[model samples]
Target: MNEQLTPRQLMILVAYFIIGTTILVVPSALAAEAKQSAWILQLAGTGSGLMLIALYVQVFKRNANSNLFQINERLFGRWIGKGISLTIALLVFVFCAQVLYYIGRFVTTQIMPDTPSEAIHVLFIITVVVGMRMGIPSIARTAEIYFPWVLLLFIFFILFIMPDIRVNQLLPAGEFESMSLVRGALQVMSYSFLPMFVTFASLNAAYDWRSSMAKAFVYGTLLSGVMLTVLVMVSTMVLGPDNTTTQLYPTYVVARKINVGNFLQRVEVIVAFLWFILIFIKLILYFDVVIMGIAETFRITKHAKTLTVPVGLLIAIFSAVVYPDYVYQQEWDNTTWVAVALLIGLAYPIALLFLSLFRKRKAAAK
Candidate 1:
């Protein structure tokens, strides 16, 4: 028996997943490539992402009572629908692992330089597993409680770091290249919101499927885009593009620069604290989706208890082995892999929309 989530719970899950660790990494990375135009890329990416969301909305609107798994079964027939469901489940598993890996690596390298990546990974996994075992309602409740603190901390961090920002450093005033911005935005769209398709699909099974999903998506995108744009602009102003490109954690570096008189020095600790909370929320949401997905596919009754340890172990092992080093990972992300992601994330939904339409028309003619 699958449990249904309320609309408020669904909204929190969407918001938390959308705002995860990517918030920490993306601004610096996009700024490195797009520079002052990074915000433009983010805006363009959000627009492109919304188009994909529309396709998803169309599918859900057509079959408002069914989840993606059920929709797949209807659209593709029994065997193929099962295959599609498994494929989506596997993708969510891999995504969850990769997110955990990235968070562990970030913690080890940036905040606690002395801590082993394995130790960090284990601790992170433990926290996520505990949350997943508690069920979706618990996770949603946790977010509601912590969300205000997360927002407050983010505001404080941004304000405290503003004093260190050098406005002149933000510009030699380069020409705006529209094409480059579009390309960069396309890249972001591939990685960021596309993953949310799976989550949205999963949640649709349990929530009231309608325009509300689209509303949540738009709100989440706008919130994430604004934060990312501010982070990029601030990092550019403080570190300059050339230097920002070379740095590992440009936002962290910017946070380290905060110095308010003699009293408020060493505020990077606070930044790390806030980021840890966000990352934990992200990990838990992904873990929840993966567990729920596996249970739904296999027709299991008690999902929360059954799959927790196995998935955690799988993520731990895979995260350690996913990349030889950060450079290789970055290269893979920037090159052909992201293009493949765009196809899966963006193109796949559009294909489904067309197929659904053709099916409807043929049935109507008959």
Candidate 2:
């Protein structure tokens, strides 16, 4: 299928992918680990993420006309490439499932305790399926429309709560160790940027090649990193490290503190609404990339129409199966799981760039 989407549409997709479930939980999660120094971790993650983008851009440039599966086949021969593609596809599918489940569980617990998580899962799957069926351009256009409102709500809530910020709460009073900071940076990097590896696989299908993608990746990562930094800083400055660690959603807690003149309380609803929109866009973008990957792998014509419902359903079911409960998932994410993500998102791409360079040299010699 040669259905081409516009650069604007692709940019929207990229933006949505860059700011999804991570934004909702990462600030509080990383704050628990790194305390007031969490912003440093976020900054480090953004710098490292840019390096990963460079590697992805190299791969995309080298195989500009091919999807990831095709590129792998060309680079590593048919069988090895198929194995690599299958492994990547499976990993991405698992990641998508986890994202869906996390969002569903979060909405049920935080917003509507009476509503079952399964219902939220179904609703989310339906929306994703509809968006995927509509095609990438439609999904991208929808993201562009919703993104501004989400950003406005985010900015307004952040501004409204600024008066409550207590700067002393973030004072680096405790003894700091460089090793601990490095570990914290690694953890935060895993949480923030590692999941984005799934999207790079489909970059060949994206329009405008290097400039558009490089711009989107750089600006979007910076934008998200800045927002997340502000969120962590505000949480630290308002709640203190101990209270920030105890709270499930410290950013939401900060929003709850937004009581301008005693009339502006209960702003958490606005925060929750924005979270829903941002996460929904993120999930849809991931769904789009996974669908495209499947199509390219199988060389299917009109893959979008045929795969949308099935993939969405699979994600819903897989989401429930991925973790026994939210606590287990949280533990997994904090420790070994996130480390694995960093390896794939950062380490693997860098390795690929080196491998590609070696291949090019050998071909030139011949």
Best by TM-score: 2
List model 1 lDDT by residue over 106-170, tens digit each: 88887788988888888889888888778766777788787788778778888998777788875
Q: Where does model 1 exceed 4 Å of error?
A: 1-11, 172-176, 301-304, 362-366
User: What is candidate 1's CA lDDT for residue 115?
Assistant: 89
TM-score of each: 0.91, 0.92
Candidate 1, poorest ten consecutive residues by summed lDDT: 1-10
Whole-structure CA lDDT of model 1: 0.72
Question: lDDT per residue, candidate 2, 180-247, as tens digits?
Answer: 66666666567656666656566566546644666766677777777777878888888888888788
Q: What residue runs in model 2 are displaced by over 4 Å at the alpha carbon?
A: 1-12, 173-175
> What lDDT score goes with residue 145 in model 1?
81
